[model samples]
Target: MANVRQASWDGSPVYELENGTFLASLIPEIGSNAYRLRDKIAGRDVLRTPERPEELRASPGHYGVPLLLPPSRIRGASFPFNGRTYRFEPNTPDGHYIHGFVRMRPWRVVDTSADGDTASVTTEFRTADFPELAPQYPHDLTIRARTELNGASFVQTFSFRNGSDEPAPFGFGLHTWFLLDGEPERWTLKLPVSDIWELNEKLLATGSRLPLGRYEALNEGMNLEGQNMDMAFRIGDRPVEAVLSKPGYAIRYSANEPVTQWVVYTKGEARDTICIEPLTWTPDAPNLDAGPELTGMRAIAPGEELIVRTTLSIERE
Candidate 1:
C-alpha cells in the first residue's frame, strides 16, 4: 500500500497514534485490505493479523474494518422506492449484500496532516449518486467513510446524503475484532445482553429476539471454554461497556449512545476467538423486521441527507 500516490491517512508504510499507544499496519493485502491495531502502551495487540492467528487477518470480524460495511457485500436486492420493488446482486456468497456504498470502493484521500504527535485522514466518495446506486441499493445516496487515529482510538465516521426524493433505511458501526488471551478461551465477555435473535445457517435473523436462556450476561464472568456464537443479541445498542481479560492484561470497551446489542461469533468452531461485534442494528435489518433498531434503513425526503457518527475506544485495565 506504500505507493507513490494511493492517498492514505497520516503517513503510509507504518502506524502509531499521537499518544503513542495504538499501532496499525497495512498488511493482509488480498482478502481484507485494512490496518491492524496494537496498543503499544499496554504491550497487547488490540487486533489479530494473519501472523497472530492462523484464522485471522482475513475477514475476521471485519478484520480491516471500514465505514458503511466491510469484509463482504451489501445485499439488499429488493428495497422499497416509492412503492416499487428493486433488486441487488449478492455482494457475497451469503446471499444478501452489505457495507452500504463504500465497502469495496477504495477511498480517495481528501486531507492528510501530521503534527508532532497527532495525525488524521479524510476520504470521500461520489458517483452519479443515484441510479448507479439504484442497481446496488434500492435508494440513491452519497456516503463518506473516514478513518482517524488520535491516541488510543481508531474512529470511523460514515456520513450519508440521501440523494433521492426520500429517506433511506441504513445502519453503520464497527465490525471490530478483539484478540483474546491465551488459546482464545482464556477470556470472558461482560455485557448487559438480555436477548439474542435466532438466525438460520445463512446468518439471517429468524424474526425474533429471545431472552438468553443459556447465554447469560457476564455481570461477573463467563468462560469461553465451551461457547460458540454466530449470533446477534439485543442489548439496547446503548453504547454498552464490556471487558475482556487474561492473566495479566484486560481490555475495557465502551462507546457513545450506550450500545445495547452484541453479536458473538465463533468462526465455525464450537469455540475460538469470539467476535464481540458492537452494531447499530440487528442482522438482515430493514431487510427483516426482526428486533428493535433503526435497521440501518431510513426514509429521506427530497434533497435530504442523513449522517451517522459513532465512537468507541480501548482501555488497558
Candidate 2:
C-alpha cells in the first residue's frame, strides 16, 4: 500500500489516501474538508466536487463534505440561550445565518499517518482564534476533525470541546454531496426514517413533524427519476443508514446516535448529485423553544466535549 501523499489543489494543500481500490482526498485549508472519495475500480466518485477547483475555493459550500456547526439555518441569525441573546451576521442574503462559519475558514493540521492498510489525517480549529466570531457564538470551542480511509470505507469524526467556563449549546453535522456513475433516473435510494420536519415558506422548520406519506418510498428502494425533495427527517437511537445505488455500484452512509436529524436534497436543477446531511439538530433549532432532547442540541458543560462519527462504505455489484 502507498502512504498518504500531499498535493496542491489550486495552490491549497490537500492530502490523498490511495489503495488498490479507493482514493480519498482531504483539504485542511478549507475547514479540513474531504472533497473527494473515489472508487478507482468502479471509476466513479462517491463524493462529489465542484466542476472547477477555484469554484470550491471561492465557495466551499458548493462542493465537498463541509462541516456545519449549529448546522443549517438559524432564523434571523439570532437565538436566545440561557437568558441571553446571541446574534450572528447572516451568511445568506435572505437574512439567515446559514451554515456555520468554520467551513470557509482554515484549520491546522494536527496529525497525519498512513500504513499498509490505512491512511488518516486530523485537523483542529479553535474558535478563540477567530475573535470576530466571538460575540455571536460566545463560547470558546475547539473543533477537532479526522478523516480516515481504510479498505473501501471512509470515516469522518468530529470532536467539539467547550473551552469556556460556562455551558454552551452545540450541534454539528456534515454536508456531503454524492455523485453516481449514471443519470439520476438510474439511481435508487433507501433511507430509514419515519417522520419529517414540516418547513415554512422560508424553508425553516415549523416545529411540527409529519408522517412520510408518499415519501415513504424511501423506506424501501425508490427510483430517483422525477423525484424532487428537500426535507429533514427525525432519527431514533439506532444507527441510521442511507443507501444510494446505481446499476453496478452502491454507496452506504451510516451515522450513529446524537445525529438525530437527516436532511436530504435532490432538486431537479442539481439532479447530477444528491446531498445527505446527517445533523445533530433541525434547522433553526436554537430559535425553536423545543427542549434540548427534542431539538438535538447538547449543552456541553465547561471542559466537556461532544463527538459524532459517520462512515461511508462503497460496494460494487
Candidate 3:
C-alpha cells in the first residue's frame, strides 16, 4: 500500500499521496493556504506566511486560492440566472460582504500524492446557504480542485458539475495571488488587451470600455511603493503577460486563453502582494446574459460536465 501522510498546514489536515502532489488543505485552518513551490536558491519569499488559513493563501499579502461564489461571498440576484441568493452565514466580519463562496465550508481530501506535490480536493455547496433566495434557486453541484506541481509552476484544474435535474447556477475560479515588493501602482502592466472595462461600485460589470492608454504596458509593474490598486482589464484572445520588477526581484507570468481578464488587486502594505487571478470567464459570467444573473448560464444536462483547464507559468529574473 502507498503511504498516505496526513499533516496540517493550518488546522486542516493536509493529505499527501504516493507522489509529490498535495491533494487538499481544508480552509480557515491549515488548508486555506495555497501550495508552496519555491526556487529555494534564490532566497525568494514563495512561502508567503507561516500562519494557517491566511498563510495558505497565494501570499501573506493576497487572498490566495479563493474558491469564489459557492462559499466565501454570494452575489445577490440579477439576470443571467434568477432566484433568492444565500448569505455565507456572515463568513467574515470585516465590514462589507464578500462575493459568492470562496472559503466558508470545510473541504474534503478525495485523493493525494505521497511526496505532497499533487492532489485533488472536492467541495460541495447548496443553494440553501443563500437562505433568502433558496426556494427559487434550487440546484445541486460539485466543485473539484485538482492541483499539480510541474517543475516550477503550479497548475490547478477546476471541474464543476451540475449534478441534478435543474441546471445548477454558479460561477467558479481559482484565486492565485502573488507577493509584490512595492506598491502595485508603481508597476507597469503588459497584457494582450486593447481596452479596459469600468465596474460599478458594487463590483459588477458596467459593459463600458476604457482605452488601455499608454502602451502594451500600463500602470502595472511600475514599482509604485505607496499606492494600491484593484482593477480588472479586458484582454484579447491571446495569452496575457504580467511583468513585475523591483530592485531585488523581477517576475513574469503567462497563461493561455479563457483567462483573458486579469483581476489585479493589491494593498499598500500588510505584506505587499498582488492577486492575478486566471478566470475562464468574467467575474460574473452568468450575470452578463439575460434573465437572472444566472441566465445564459450553461447547464450540465444532469450527467454532463463542465471542464475548465488553465495553466500558469512564472519565472524570476
Candidate 4:
C-alpha cells in the first residue's frame, strides 16, 4: 500500500509520499522541491537532505531537486528572445544571472492521492500569480510539477506552458543533489552522456562539443575516487539511463527527450554528494550563436507546452 499526506520537516510544511520500500518528501512552498527520498528497505537516503529548514532556505539549490528555469548561467544577466531582451537580477558572484529565481519561490499544491501501489502529489506555479515575476521575464508562463513514489522508484514530472501572448524562450533543469555512502572512493558512476561541452573559465558552455576522449570510461563505470568534475555533456533523445552505485546499492536515473544535456559535479577531496543534473539547454545557451540543435536553445510559442519526466530508482543488491 502507498500513502500521501502533509507532514512537517524541521518546522517546514511538506508533503510525504510513501510506499512500502521508499519514502519521498517535498515542500510545496519551496520550488515544489523534493528534498528527501529514502530507501526504507536499505535504511539509507537516496538524496542529500538539509539538516534543517534554515540550511535549505540559505541555499535552496544545493540540497534537493530544485527546478531551474532557463537553467544555468546566462551571460551579463540578460538575453535576447523574439527581438525583446529579457533580464534577471544578477544572482551569481560573477555578476551573472544563474539558474533563475524560480527555485526560491513558493508553489501551490493542487492535489495529493494514494493508490494501491503509488502515492503522488501535484503542485503548480504561474508567473501571473506572482506580481514580481512579470518584470523579470515579462512572459506569462506556468509550470505544473508532480512528484510520485511507486514501490522502489521516485519520479518527478514537470509540465511547462507558455501562457503569454507571444512566444517565450524556454529552458529547464533540476539541480539534484545525490547523497554518497561510505567513502567516496567506494562508489562508481555510469552516465549516458556521449560528448562533453567545452566550457570557459566561468563554467559556461563555449558553443562547442568535444568527444569523451579520456573520460570515455564514464560510459562504462568509473570510480569516484579523486575525481574532480563540474562538467556538462550531451545526451541522446532516446531514453538513456545513468547509474550511481556502491557495493550494496545503486541509484538509477533517467530522463527522456527534450532534455538534451546533463551536468555532472562532484568535489574532488571534499566529496560528500554528487549532482547529476538534467538540463534542457546548455549554460549560457541564449548567448550562444549556434543553432538550436547544437546549443539546445529554443523558444516555446504561446500556448505551446513542454513535458519532461525523470525518475530515480533504487536497486538493492
Candidate 5:
C-alpha cells in the first residue's frame, strides 16, 4: 500500500508520498512544487532538487516541477485579452516577465489520501483569496493541483477555473528539471515535435516558425553529447510524448490534448540537468501577431474550467 505523511524539509513543511517504487515530496508552502522524486528500484532521483530547501525557495522554477501560469517569457510584461490589457511586473533584466509568479506563491493543501496502490495530495490556489492580486490580475481564478504516485509513475493534474464573468486568457506550463545520471553524453532525448517557434534576442516568440528540419534528430532519439537547447517546439495535433533515457532506465513524460508546445533547455557540457517543459502555448502568445489557432492562445469563458494532466513514468531500458 502507498502512504503519505506530513514531513519537514530543512524546517519547511513538506508532504511526503511513498509507494513501493517511488518516494515524492510536495511543498505546499512554496508553490506546491514536487521538489523531489526518487525511484527506489533504480536508486536515482528523477528530478533535480537543491541541497537546501531555502535554495529552492530562492529560485523556484530552476528546481522542481514549478508551475508557470503563463509559461516562459512575456514581451513588455503585458498582453491583450478581450480588448483589455493585462500587465505584470517585469522580473527579468531583459524587461520581460519571465515565467509568471504563481510558482512562488503559497498554496493550500486541501486533501491527502492513500488508497489501494496510490497515494496523492491535492493543493489549491485561489486569486479570490488573495486581495492583492486583483490590482494586477483582477480575474477571479482558482487553480487546483493534484500530485499522485501510482506504482512507478508520478502524475500531476492542474485544473484552472475562471470565476469571473469575463473571458480569461490562459496558458499553463511546468518547468521540470529532469536529472541525468552518469555521463551526460550517454543520455538520449526524444520529442514529438513539429515546428520550432522562432524567437527574438530576448527569447520571446517572434510570430514566426522554423521548420523542424534543422532539429530532425530530436524527433528520432538524439544523444545529449554536445547538445545545447533553449528552444520551444510546436506539438502536432495529437497526444504528446517525450522521453529522456539514461543507462539503466528511461523516464517518459506525456500529456493529453490542449497541450500544444514544449520548451527544452540544457547547459550542454556544464551540467547534468535538463528542462523539457510542457506548455499549453508558445511564449508571448498574446503578443504574437497571429491568430489564436496558430499561436495556441486560449481563453476560458465565464464559468468555464480547463484541466491538463501530465504524467512521468519510469521504465527500464
Candidate 6:
C-alpha cells in the first residue's frame, strides 16, 4: 500500500505520496503545483523541477505544473465578457496577462488520503478571496483540483464553478514541464492535431487557422534536436493524446473533451525540458468574437460548474 504524507520543502509544506516504487510531491501553497514525480525503481524524474529553491521562488512557471486560468494571453490585459469588461495586470513584458492569477496564489487543502494503491490530495482556491485579483478579474469563482497517484501514473482533475449571479467566461489549462533524461536532440514527440493557431509577433492568437501541413511531424513523431518551437494547435472536440519518447522511457498524455487546444514550447538555450500544455481555449479567447467557436471558451452560468481531467502515464522500454 502507498502512503500519503505532508512534509516541508523549501519553507513550504509539501505532500508526498510514495509506494516504494514511485514518488510524487505536491506543493499546495504554491499554486497547488506538483513539483516532483519520479519512478523510484528506475531513478527517473518524470517532471522538471528547479535546481535551487531560489529559482523556484523567483520564477514558479519554469517548472512543474502551474494551473492557468483564462489560459494563455489576453490582448492588452483586458477583454469584454457578456456586457462587462474584465481587466488584468500585465504579467508579461509584452504587456499582456500571460497565465492568469491563480498560479502563484495559495490553495486550501481539502483532503489527503490513500486508498489501497492510490494516493490523492485535493485543493481548492476561491477567486473572491484575493484582494489583488478582485480588481482585475472581479468575478466570484472557485477552482478545485484533485491530484491522484495510482501506481506509476499521475492524474489531475480541475473543476471551475461560477458563483456570481451573472454568467462568466471560463478557460483553463496546465503548464507542465517534462524533464528529458537524455539529450534533447534524441527525443521524439507526436501530437494529434489538425490545425494550428496563427499568432502575432507577441504570441497572441490572430483569429486565423492554418493547416497542419508544415507541422506534419505531429502525426509521425519527429525528433526535437535543433528545433525551436512555441506554438499552439487546435484539437477540436476529439480526445487529445500526445506522446514524448526518449531512448529508455516514454510519456503518454491525454486530456478530456474540454481541452480543445494544445501548446508546445521548447526553445532557447534550455533544451533539457519541454512544456506540453493542454488548454480549454486558445489565446485571446475572450476577444475572439469573430470566431468564438475556434476559441473554445465556455460561459458558465451562476452556480454551474465545469470539470476537466488529464492523465499522464510513464513507461520504460
Q: Pick the candidate with the highest TM-score.
A: 5
What does the lDDT read for residue 122 in candidate 4?
Answer: 93
TM-score of 2: 0.95
lDDT for every model?
0.54, 0.83, 0.48, 0.86, 0.88, 0.84
Which ranking of candidates, highest lDDT first? 5, 4, 6, 2, 1, 3
lDDT of 2 by residue, 153-231 (tens): 8888888899899988887888898884448888998888868889898889888889889878888888887777788
For model 1, how does the per-residue alpha-carbon lDDT over 18-83 read when each residue is reduced to its tens digit? 446555553212222344666767776666454542333234445545434422223343444446
lDDT of 4 at 55: 81
lDDT of 5 by residue, 1-317 (tens): 89999997889999999999899998998888999999898888888888888898899888889999878999999998888888888899977898886898899999999987799999999988888778768889899999999987899998999999998888889999998764678798988788889988888999999998858888888898777789989987634999998677789999878788999999565257889999998999989987877778999988998999999998995
For candidate 5, the 10 contiguous residues with the lowest summed lDDT are 265-274
Per-model TM against the reference: 0.75, 0.95, 0.69, 0.96, 0.97, 0.95
What's the CA RMSD for each of the models? Answer: 5.2, 1.5, 5.7, 1.4, 1.3, 1.6
Q: lDDT, candidate 6, residue 250?
A: 79
Q: lDDT, candidate 4, residue 273?
A: 86
Stretches off by above 4 angstroms in model 3 are: 1-4, 9-11, 15-37, 47-50, 54-62, 70-97, 114-137, 182-188, 215-227, 240-257, 268-271, 284-301
Which runs in model 1 stand beyond 4 Å of their true positions? 1-19, 26-34, 50-62, 68-76, 92-94, 98-101, 115-117, 127-132, 138-140, 237-239, 258-260, 270-272, 290-297, 300-307, 310-312
Worst 10 residues of 4 by lDDT: 233-242
As for TM-score, the candidate ahead, 2 or 4, is 4
